[model samples]
Target: MFRRRPARELSADDLLTTLGRLTAQARAGAELQRARVELAEALQREMLPAALPGVPGVRAAAAYAPARNGLDIGGDWYDGFPLPGGRLAFCIGDVQGHDVEAAAFMGQIRMGLRAVAGGGADPGVVLARANELLLSVDSPLFATCTFLTFDPVAWEVVAARAGHPPGVWATADGRCGIAEENGGAPLGVLPGETYPVTYWRLAPRGAFALLTDGVVEGPSFPIEAGLAEAAKRVRDRAPTGDPADVAAAVMDVAEFTGHTDDAAVVVLCYDRADRDNG
Candidate 1:
């Protein structure tokens, strides 16, 4: 018959065995966590557009980088698609938090925005309607977004922001600056928020960049400094390459790995020759 031993009387072998079991359990837990992150990343990528739409007289491209550490998945997302009336719409947004819930919420928001924008409303009106839709949902997540509607025929763009980072615009002459316009509160925050639309003329041989906060706001950098750096990078690279190349170049210069948050960017370039000739 076996007798129960006192807690203090555990043998060295018993302690070693317990430690081994715990080590194995820890490794298994880590592996499971890694697998979850991978799955989340794949799901989030599905939410993003596989390729930017090919708009006449314009070149569009987008890039997304997941977080290097932590869950490797975030709410950052970018999308570009054709709208009615020969106009194109591009958007970038960031949902709160960096988990599966946030990713799911982001997907819903993107779909909602796309549906609302497709109805031919102005950028500001589309955002307002989107805000109302989000408020009607049961989600607790709030999101920041910047939406732009480009009219190739008029060579102009209208932009609206919901507490998101200002867009970067560069002219062919190398002049670059942030699109500082009046913006309303983030979606899901206040009901019936009115987002103001800012009108901008698209420069021939120029590019506009839209990015989530992860690209500009980091622990070591303030938003203003980061915005300046982004504008400078775009101005330096805007002289060459298409929108995709410019987007990649900007992402490289931004040093995304330095921060733990994911980054999403979209660049839209307009060529006067294409507009006039094509």
Candidate 2:
């Protein structure tokens, strides 16, 4: 998408003809691609939580960007919902492939994970069940997901990572770090083993970012370098209007710099006043 630079000045007739053809071709291609993107994005959007559950003290926003120039769909997804006992569930995941089938499998995984986690399972238990569910189905697809439970009252979180990228945490005090969990192999590849959970406390008004590997792993750049660059940008960028905007901007930057993978992210920002004032 970024390869075609804007046309420059040329002699009048030739320029007009060339520009006209190019414009028509670009317009046609863009329209066709846009239609496909819209369809894929619609399908992908179905995987996200339709409405972020109303946590008394929290307001959240989220965004997803499929690959810009590819097959118009991807296998990354994010979801947030209310957990029992007034906690909130936040998660991001990705199936290995980027086709429609992968996307369909991705939707299944998203719903399955939420269902398993919604049943009061701990992060580890949730991942174990998810793995089992995927394996028993006889499908060859594999997915990586991270499950996070946020406690608004305590500003603490319990997270489980299953072959997914580590989450990013940006604190109210301006400190940021990757939330590392004991991630197991991707689901559907292994069965009968328990995934491990990690615990951490978010400083008041902290922002937690959960992302797919596409945010870091692409064909061009090393994953570590991409991650480092992304972390720096997320930390340095001024706090935006909403969590979704923050997440989208990060992905935008990554894609702008030529990362072609389908990137997806979910950002959770907690407000201290909401907990304290209550």
Candidate 3:
């Protein structure tokens, strides 16, 4: 038989000691969660480019916002680099999580993108290689992405999508529309997945831009409506020929719509003529 211990009135010093121990434990737990978030945020900042490179006849800019919610950071990323023979490449993607593990894989996918794209592979092939690379890692996480290569001389862009949201295109004449992206399974979902390519040309003074899903979707907000609103914002702002403004215009959607996800966007506004903004 177990005997119930009698409850004794606690001395003031004993109560104070018990309270301090509980307080310390609670503080330690909170600090631990904050530390994880800080580390992931640092990793994200380190992975992103210090500055977007300049492309002939195109002014480019990108923006990133972390939900930084909960105990981890999310996996929204974008990249740009100049290719051989006056071509430029850019992409945006979201891996399937909000944890340090997601950010680590995000870095891996990014490196693969840079390496394969640096070889000047076709945009479709670039994503295919990336798919292979991700599968090789054998991580449970999958990612959605849009990859595109542009030639200013020809005013052409070849893009491929891996279950990502279609990008926005704004013509110089003040028309804005979403790209009807040829979709494939998200990376790491299928081995040897071939992402079909889509082609579009942005005439001088037009704009090509990609945004992660976070910009458009949130609780009580339909993604369709968010996308339509983004199109309107781009149309109203793209003609200004300022890539920064265009990026801001898109990011504004996330802010006003109360999205709870991390967001990223890349805006490349084709200039009427090439100028050095590098």
Pairs that collide, model 3: none
Q: What TM-score, computed on C-alpha atoms, does each candidate reach? A: 0.92, 0.80, 0.91
lDDT per model vs. reference: 0.85, 0.75, 0.86
Highest TM-score model number: 1
- Cα lDDT, model 3, residue 132: 94
Q: List the residue pairs that clash in candidate 1.
A: none
Per-residue lDDT for 22-73 in model 3, tens only?
A: 9999999999888888888888889988777766678789988878356658
User: Candidate 2 lDDT, tens digit per residue, 1-278?
Assistant: 56888887678998799899999999999888777667666777776677666475566666666676666577888788888888888878888776666777888888788889878988889989989999988888998888888888777889988888887767566676666667888889987977888888666565777777777766776766766656665665425426766676667656745767677777776777766787
Which scores greater on TM-score, model 1 or model 2? 1
Task: Give the runs in model 3 whose Cα sits over 4 Å from its true position.
Answer: 1-15, 68-71, 272-278
- Rank by TM-score (best first): 1, 3, 2
Candidate 1: TM-score? 0.92
**Model 1 per-residue lDDT at 262:** 86
Cα lDDT of candidate 1 equals 0.85
TM-score of 3: 0.91
As a whole number from 0 to 100, the lDDT of residue 124 in candidate 2 is 84
On the 0 to 100 scale, the lDDT of residue 146 in model 3 is 92
